[model samples]
Target: MSNIRHHPKTETLAAFAAGRLDEARAVVIATHAAICTECAQAIEEFETVGGAFLEDAEPVALRDDALENVLRRADPGVNVVTPQKPAGDLPETRLPLSAYLEGSIDDVAWRAVAPGLSQSVLKAEGYRPGVLRLLKIAPGVRMPRHSHKGEELTVILRGAYKDEIGDFAVGDLADLDAGDTHTPEAIGDEPCICLIAAAAPLRFKTVLGRIVQPFIGL
Candidate 1:
């Protein structure tokens, strides 16, 4: 049985099923679905409903010159390219994020964010003014107290952490919005590694955090 206590909202899951979420948010949801059977089942149901809706929808008429324009844009000499899969040696925790990361988790060049805390920012194509990162916190280290400007989604990949909401272990997801504020402390013997996506910049409660926020671009 899974120890996950928190999950993405139903609306978020539905959006993911319909491909309405941004790439960063979608990756976080995919990582959570990889371990949470309940959320995974919910996603399947949402996808089924979406498929039904599509099947029942009325078809739209195309513009008079649509076909001709499409044909003219098609180049017979152009080759279709398929994306290559990541190497088999990649860690399971990072497999869902392989397309974004150039290498495995161990290969990431981490930058120190604070004492005992480091982060590796991930770049998503076409996503701007949003945040996606992998955070590594040493055991017993606490993150700076903060709240979100928008929404924040975090999925624990290894080790564990405790926040105001609850304890989160491997595969557990913590979904927080602007209304929530808390400091997460890494627990257990190993370093806690988590994948996070944020819709907006964070609002730190402390002066020191605010001072460094501009520099870190958080």
Candidate 2:
């Protein structure tokens, strides 16, 4: 993220390393780690550190049906559905490593929030605590300004959005924290689709912006 420092908190990475994050949320971060070497290294460090802790820990025996219960819960058929791709002409941008034709992100439900902004929220699939929303920004439209209550990671899907930090094209990931506050304008002729995993609802700083918050599902 240009002008914004959005490194995941140590605790978050630690949770991810421990198989504790929600499946869908984990998928998002996993995608991020694949593109951001810095985050990948951090995840590696977390895993390395976690492995040592695991080695030092004692094994506990599960009750009679505990294993069966876990197995049932872990059934292969159980998985989160990816949202469908928004139909529109999108500018050139980086898509996540997921399949372009069909994947986890090509089958969820999308809801409109504003004139050029729309989103689809996925069910939390694992230990993740917040909601994951896919946002589609219309071209040539600037989003309402806002700040986050917690951390937000935006993975560019199609096209680009620009702010004071700079332009983020396809595959570009922006990590924002509580201090970030900027309006993003879809700069290309086509629309921009971004995947955002956020723990808290966004706080629109302007009253007029806030008035539109409910409509935007932010």
Candidate 3:
């Protein structure tokens, strides 16, 4: 975590602190914040500022039935079960993210998308118009050059990779937006594994990548 050289942009963290980001993108931001001290501090600062702003805002009157409705929702006998946090140590999947996974990184059931490339799409509610997935690239493998239609957030979880943008290792988050294009190549001895939250589908540049796009659904 100490060597992390990349982080989400300030505006992205601000959106997260304000609870404005979509669930899938928020998960990626939270996962990165758990490991990166700098990003965590930045998020905290944003939260603190947001809290101050809220405190200064004018108050609005609530409906006469609001308090009664709240008490009814808070009743333990309502039969709604609140999810308990996972106990003890977390797996390599890390906090927040660990809650979303069945097990550690090695336990992922991957589907091969291309030679030396595998992926596992994560399912969760409230991620419409976007997707969350884990990608594993074998050492020496290079992803096809591509650009985004919207935003793409990628956090390295295992091994490392290098692209036109820069090198990325564990805990480093690459925050890219529309028009950004690069071909990432796994750089270490091991395969590079990353968690990605994409707002829209990628636009592959090469003919081979275009042909394979439908099959991979990336």
Best of the candidates, lDDT: 3
lDDT comparing candidate 2 with the true structure: 0.71
Total clashing residue pairs per candidate?
Answer: 0, 17, 0
Model 3 RMSD in Å is 2.4
lDDT of 3 by residue, 76-111 (tens): 887687766645454464567777777777789999
The TM-score values for the models, in the order shown, are 0.85, 0.67, 0.89
How much is the lDDT of residue 143 in candidate 1? 77
Per-residue CA lDDT of model 1 for 1-218, tens digit only, reads 36688899888899889988877888899989977889999999999999999999999989999999788777565546665774565456245777777667777899987778888989863444567899999999987789998878899988999998889998888878765898999999999999998888789999888988877666
* Stretches > 4 Å off in candidate 1: 61-83, 90-94, 125-128
How far residue 61's Cα lies from its native spot in candidate 2, in Å, is 8.0
- Model 3, residue 33: C-alpha shift (Å): 0.1
- Candidate 2 vs candidate 3, TM-score winner: 3
The best candidate by TM-score is 3
Off by over 4 Å in 3: 64-93, 125-128
- Candidate 3 local accuracy as lDDT? 0.89
TM for candidate 3 is 0.89
